[model samples]
Target chain A: MDFFIQLFTDPVAFWNSHTLLIAQIGINSIIASSMFIVLYSGQLSLAAPGFMAIGAYTSVLMDLHWHTPLALNLAAGVVLAGVVGVLVGLPVLRLRGVFLAIATIGFIEALRLGVILNLPITGEGLGLKNPTADPLGGINMVLVSLAVVLFIMWRLTKGRLGAAWAAIRQDELAALSQGIDVARYKMIAFVLSAILAGFAGGLEAHLNFFVDPGDQQYGVTRAVQILTFAVLGGSGHFLGPVVGALVVTTLPWVFQQAHDYINIVTGVFLIAVIVFRPQGIVGRGGLAIVRPAWWPRRARVSAPSPG
Target chain B: MDQQLLNAIFIGSIYALFAVGYTLVFGVLDILNLAHSAVFMFGAAITYSMVVNHGLPFWVACIVGIAACAVMGLVIEHVCLRPLRRRRAPPIAALISTVGLALIIVAAIEQGQTGSLFAWLWVDGPNSVAFPAGTIPNPTWHVGDLTLEASKVAIIPISIALMLVLGYVIRYTQVGRGLRAVAENPRAARLMGLDVDRMISLTLVISSALGGLAGILFGVALSDISPYIGRDNVEVRGLAVIVLGGMGSIPGAVIGGYLLGLIEVLALVVLGSNARGGVAFAALFLMLVLRPQGLFGAQLRERI
Candidate 1:
């Protein structure tokens, strides 16, 4: 009605805080979706932040060092990050679970350290500045981009590659035994994940109008947060990360209004989720609310009936 | 050559202590406990508060901090880990949740303490504590004039004693054997009537205690703590040790720690401190590339 008209035509009439909040939502959605690709493939690549760092750096370099067009710079940023992801994944895919987790962490650390040492380009530990505002306009562009990316991701996951990746996640050896090329699937997932993360990073750099090593920590921390969202929403489902992201991102704003007990609240909620309902809010074995047709057969049958 | 080697050993011992805690949890439960570094930092923070604010003795503060760390580890096991185990949570969930726990810890600590207020709470300002810098001021046992410092002399004995005690506990203690059994096969151990959950909790407690010990030592060596001691390169170093030493081997932990420490120190000595971070990361990358299973790890058995 009036809200939709205002949202598109007179969006500026809305409160600045609300606009920023929506922007935040869009940004986090990109991050969550980027992370979901790898989770789908059965890997927890903790180095999402490292790739984000690369993207951010590349964008900054393009803007400052070369003064390139925003579109070109961002494309290059995403591509560079994907290349790095491919390189990192090649060696680490052989590792499983905790080993892969550690390796990815190491990858992040290495890149962060490299940025620190390479002061001439990366601005060293002091961090880089001189960020410009988003060229396509802030909230609108982000919203449009998010819709496109989500649609693309949704389509991708429904295709053959998605099934193959899921099989690899379920059982890598079994997938290989069934003639699925595990390494190629892993690499595709890695590169695709990195590209999305990098794209988000590039957009964020323009949104924030600056980049720094500190921002790398944000990426790393958010990557973990995004993974939490996926798990909390049931990573087995396509819409899991998105739903989880909406809850987690919005929860903080709600808590912010109160200001007190933020950490205690977040900490307790996280603990409860991990302990009591590790399958997550909408997850199987949780509250067997109307079972969606998409719910896996094994999960649906295993649900404990609530008398 | 002598000074560099001694520096390597000094740094190596510290990393070795940190790695011991990380490796113990990995070895016993096959869980990385991503919150471990935060726990380590908490130990140092607790010690700093006790020593500087409460005027407690150093050793007493260290013990109290370690005890608290053990309790925290147990709490994490009870509150976070056990439920996940029962629910058969995916490994990714476990890892991410722990990391979230870490973020919660860091944010809470940051907000509560306002780190800047306590940044200089325990600094020794001008009278810098000194460790033996050179190989020997005057080599009494002059092995070709290669001198050694008094601190260097102490490092070997302390590390060796700690390792031996750890080894003895793991080899002879019933609890230790139960931990090994749980790590090898949780279902089998469960059927054998071992309390799997309790054993896992004990593993976390032991690892946290070791981390606390390392924290106290690191504070002593660095001469300052800012509630951010374990947040930096240490966790990465610890993870590297676990990976490079074989994912779950204690001896591998020690060897990996020392080797990484040596590589880092040598990189610093030759390349400059500015390059140390890069060197540490480069070493980790090489390790990942060369042996994904780690130096002491056997090929991982793929789960059916």
Candidate 2:
């Protein structure tokens, strides 16, 4: 209760005191926005976490080995993740919907358990310490990168590419009939989404002093968390996931009293959202609900459609 | 070689038990019931509670656990699935809804332990108890240069019996026919005077019961109960099984279950336990890429 009250009452104080939380929220929003791209194109690819893992590990390892500036390491991380995304996407994209989801999960688990756990370069899963971690320096970078990603997403969605994506998402056969390359457009979205997730991952690793390769860090759990942001925020619009990231990242602070039951609460809320507002918290028409028949009519301004 | 084969068949039967239920839900409903595993965990939890906390007989506890799972299945269908189905929501909506249901159930079971440590300690902790093997006799079978724990060998025939029973019911019973009809075309089934809702509900009950039975078998065979056991092992392997067997194919699920079991165990022996899980999924990844239709699945006409 006080958490919410404090935020509402002392906005500046809250922002100053919760800089880390704010930065984390910004990073999650970037990941969520990236998820929004894949979902926008009707793909159920849950490979964000895997890409995040790739980005985090690549950047952190480069930093540890060469003492490269953070920008170079982060860039390499994003590029490598995108490359892997393409490589993985080519074969697995043949399966649709839930099958695709499961296959991607397989990809992530194999990567985490088979490669990461076994590889000595990843510190053999004991995790690596980040000596030059800037706990405070990252906030500006996160906020600025988030702005750039959002701008790019907004412009992309408004362009011909976004139209192609929308058509593919709506109906692939129809999209193909219209001469839109369904496979190519999907690959583009998948790759773009990977790039965004990778960027988020690199930024996240930069925020902390340690890079942990635990399953929780880059496994099915993280995948679900990414999915939750899109689902709760409403995947129909770009803004939906951004808002979702904000609310979900802040929920524990908001419902401080029920922190222990946060998972159940989030689960219930997600289920309820799907049931009641299948479009999500933000819909095409800006929020939707089925009002009971007993609710007052719109002042009976019009009863003339039949006539 | 014989010992490895025996080990494979033993674990294969148990994997078949869990995979069959998972496949059944997917076959009929055409959506993954991610909470199927949570129901599996609940069965073990209930059995553990009854045996250790209440001191009930093992058989009695198993029966009660199965019954409770059946009820829990109905609740999931009602709470998580029915609303979305009625609204004619997208398939992914149903998928995500099931995930949400899984999350809630797992949280409730784990006592809100999100992203916790490795599962060994959690399962054998003070809260849950090991299955009492005394309730089912422990014996051994021996041959030249080979010995098999009766508990393990029993899984093959026991699972075979259960599969036979399931096959018979699906082939011969009225309710089974209704389920198949609905699976083929829900609207058509409804037009044909079939109660589609009732059939779906009944299917959930049966699927959940199978999951519960599988959990109990795991408890008896492994002699331990842990909430993590269901989602961790079942989620990945059950998925690989369904895909390998051919989606919506019962025989495919069973065969794929055993095949995957063989592959996992053999992979463990060859690659070491740490890399064994990756081997199964690597197999799945390859199978999906090369043969998306699976061994027995109908040829897929579309690609994502």
Candidate 3:
């Protein structure tokens, strides 16, 4: 396709023309990282969009009412999002698996339909206008912030906290037996994820120059998109979701000709990836999943252990 | 209040039809079939096409629609579920796949109806389709101050009859025994010589059929249908019903459906319709937090 040819032949031009695309990728990558934390802790919490909305509205409201500095506003947004995450996580963390997923979905819909759509300050679903929005200028900030967040996440995963999270993910009962405090570690991961989503939301609102509380903006649809990032990329490693975000965001541009059929392709691709590579695109090792677990371990395997 | 109660029962019965199918699948497989909503929408569309376009009798249309839903269910189980089941994948994998399947089916429906790029693949599609005429009539019955639509009485009885039949089958039939056995413990059922696979397939067929019935009845109630109606109209409310009824309990589903129906209607009266939608979900959230077992279900014990 010409799109591919243009990208490869004129890299600089591609970058220049696709500045918005690059920035969007950066924002989505941050949100993907936010998704990674909750999944890493074995919590299937679909509460990222809810937190993102909180962050976006909080920062914008601050700017509108008190004319706070951007730094202060963003910080307040992130912290408040984390605090609300804690409050929401406390009651919700009791549930696991599908129950947790549905509950979080309920949280998102209730927040959007009840609070965001009803409140006049949010323009009652008509959306908000950000006069001080820096649409073209925030790309640098997004890139920098994404870098910092990824580095922090990578470093965090290499620590004892990360070890505890892995243990919990592997088996919650086993984690509790080891005195790892399952609830606390899950809450920490959830709150950290909320903070990342909040930060991403604030940055995204700035770039868009509006805080539209649309269904697709802060609803189940966005939650599903964020989930796809982690699933398609492979949730095992930090890099998986980042790559997932990159690929998923760019796919539309790449497949411009199949715009109408794009949803069908994405759907089929999602199903294929899930069926073929349950571990993900960036998961550990190669495509050969002929491990001992596939068959019964020690089920008369004449050879040595596969691992 | 009597009139309002009649209204709630009518609405709730339709929701219960969809909800029970949802819960039935969940009960046996322990995975949410996200495509069930699409199946529900498909049912409505199929019924519309049969009676309106094909000029079939209403009863014939209902049979065709229900049969088609069963086939769709079987396809979903085989395509989306069987592979994952064999691999012993997590529950979320199945959920994601179903969501993906939902998108494809819904998109196909849209393309088919609109006669987009592939005209050959077209079926009824994206826009709102009016319910076929001469199927059901709406007539009010009055006795003193109490007045109610005749269709409401009929609709509520249909739901109750379906629920009663389902409960009886699960309690009495040979296939029902196999279903319960599998639901209780698949491995144990397999060891006991029960056909787990066959039972699961049957569950899908029966459940999908319920969804078909719900879709047609809902079309009659609303007098029209849309492709996008699944998410907001049936899926969410069906979920609320199952959760409220106690996830796997059949009777719980019935009571929960009517209960939520009453709550929605009364809440509309008190808070107005604008806030009513949120109030229902907010109630579901609060209920989960307060009584995660739902109103009638057993206490949840954490499984290792």
Candidate 4:
């Protein structure tokens, strides 16, 4: 209640006090958008965190070693992630559905546990420290990046490329018959998602003082969380995942009253929301509530016969 | 090497048990029950609580824990999968819902302090605990360099017998026929007078029961039980097992489980402990890339 009250009643003070939370929301929204691209293209690829790891490590490493500006560092990270994305995407894009999802899970876990945790440059299990992190100051940049990413998504989804993606999503065989290159479009979406995830990772690295390589950071857990954002938000629309990111990231603050039982509330909320709104919160239908089949219908009072 | 091999087989039994339930649902309904792991942990947690907290005998506690997990499976089917099935929502939606249920179950156990709401369920409050010493009879045996505990040795026979029983039931029983009919084609099964929904519900029950039993064995054998046992121990590894053997293949899951145990042991021996987890996932990745159908799986069918 206080969370909502403050947001509605005193916007300026709320921003000043909850800058970190707001910044996190921005970063999550960006990652969620990255998830959105793959889901929109009918792919259940969960390789976002893997790409994010590459982006994060590359950027942070550059900053630590050469003292490069943040822009150059971010750019290098994004490019490296894209290159890795293409390399990984080629063989992986051959798989579909849950197979793709599992394969990607394997990718992220291998990257985190196999590569990142083993490399001395990545600080092994200890994680790297970013001495020049600017937590509060990075908020504006994050918000701006989110806006730009969303804009690009909106435009892309409305264009010819988006049509090809929608076609492929609906039916790969049918889309192929219609002359759409299923593999190419899937690769495109996967690579684009990687680039965006990489960008989000770079921004997130700037926000925190330590680049932790824990399971919650760049592991399957993070991948699932990002998936939740796209899923809960509605992967059908560009804005749905962003809304999901906002709702999910703010859930802890919103359910502060639940305290230790917050996860229960979150779990119940997730089940209820998905059960009721399987298409997600921001789907094709306007804000209508979906009642399950088991719910009893209201008694219809018949009008008196006019005869 | 002989001792390690013994350890591998012991741990492999648990992995095989856990993956059996995971692959069962996938085989029948083609939906990954992410909450299966939660049921696994819940089984161990409840059994631990029964023995230590409520003074129940270990065997009685085990039965009750397994029954409770069976009930949890029903809840999952009704609350998470059924509604979505009715709505004809995409399979991905089921993933999210099951994840939600998993969260609730884990949290319920994690928050179970002395006076907390879930105190009846768990009282550890997110801490890892083991069954108290002497709660279950555990006698140790030493054969040359190999040291074995009764608890660990028991896992091999129990898991193999149960799996063989499951295999027989799946292959020969009337209920198994119904389940296979449903799995092969739901519409056709319904047309053939098989209750598809019931079969699905039954699948959950059997799967969750096996998962629970596996968890009990794991906790008893490894001497660790917590809200995180499922997550930390077998959640992802379960996936690798099913995939390695082939998704939706019972025999494959069994083989894959032992194979994974062997591989992890081998990785530990050769590449060190740090590479153990990485090696497993790398195997999973390579398996999917080179052979998406797995060893026992039929030709891959795309499902989302």
Q: Looking at every candidate separately, what fraction of the true A–B Cα contacts under 8 Å does it contain? A: 0.44, 0.55, 0.51, 0.73
| Candidate with maximal DockQ | 4
Candidate 1 lands at a TM-score of: 0.85
Residue B33, candidate 4: C-alpha displacement in angstroms: 0.5
Q: TM-score of model 1's chain A, to 2 decimals?
A: 0.83
Using lDDT as the measure, which candidate wins? Answer: 4
lDDT of 3 by residue, B1-304 (tens): 7677778889889888888899889989999898898888878777777777677887898898889899988988887787788778778778778888888877766766444664333355567777645466667778778877665567888988998999899888888888888988999999999878788888889999998788878876777666676766877777788878777777777788888898889888888777877887887788778877788876422110
- The most accurate candidate by TM-score is 4
Instruction: Give one digit per residue, the lDDT tens place, for model 3 in A1-307.
Output: 7778989999989888899999999999999999999999898988999999998998899999999988888999899999989999999999988788888888987888888888898887688888998877888999999999989989888999889999999999999999999989999999999999999988888888788887678887789888988878888899889988998888778778877778788788778777776777888666655232234566565888699
How do the residues A70-189 of candidate 4 rate in per-residue lDDT, one tens digit apiece?
999999999998999999898899999999999999999999988888999999999999998999999999989989998999999999999999999999999999999899999999
Q: List model 1 lDDT by residue over A1-307, tens digit each.
A: 4444555777667445367667877877787787788888998776677777788789878898789988898899999998888888878887776666667766776677655446777788777775576643677878888999889887888999999999998898899999999989998998998898888888777777657676235434555666777777667666777777777776766566436446556766666555555666665654744322223656355678799
Provide all candidates' interface root-mean-square deviations. 5.3, 2.6, 2.9, 0.6
Residue ranges of candidate 3 with Cα displaced over 4 Å: A289-307, B117-125, B132-135, B140-147, B150-152, B299-304
Model 2: per-residue Cα lDDT over B1-304, one tens digit each? 7788777887788788888888888888888888888888878877776776667887898899999899988987887788878777777777667778887767776762324431321333324457655766788778987887776777788889999898888878887788888888889999999989888898889889988888888877777677677867687788888889877777888999899989988888888888888888888888888887788766432110
- lDDT of candidates 1 onward, in order: 0.72, 0.82, 0.83, 0.93
Task: List the per-model TM-score of the A chain.
Answer: 0.83, 0.92, 0.92, 0.97
Runs of candidate 1 exceeding 4 Å displacement? A1-15, A215-222, A257-261, A285-307, B1-4, B111-156, B298-304
Candidate 4 has what TM-score?
0.98
Which residue pairs come into collision in candidate 1? Answer: A131-A209, B135-B147, B135-B148, B136-B147
DockQ for each model? 0.30, 0.48, 0.52, 0.84
CAPRI quality band, candidate 2:
acceptable
True contacts kept of 1: 0.44
**Which pairs of residues have clashing backbones in candidate 2?**
none
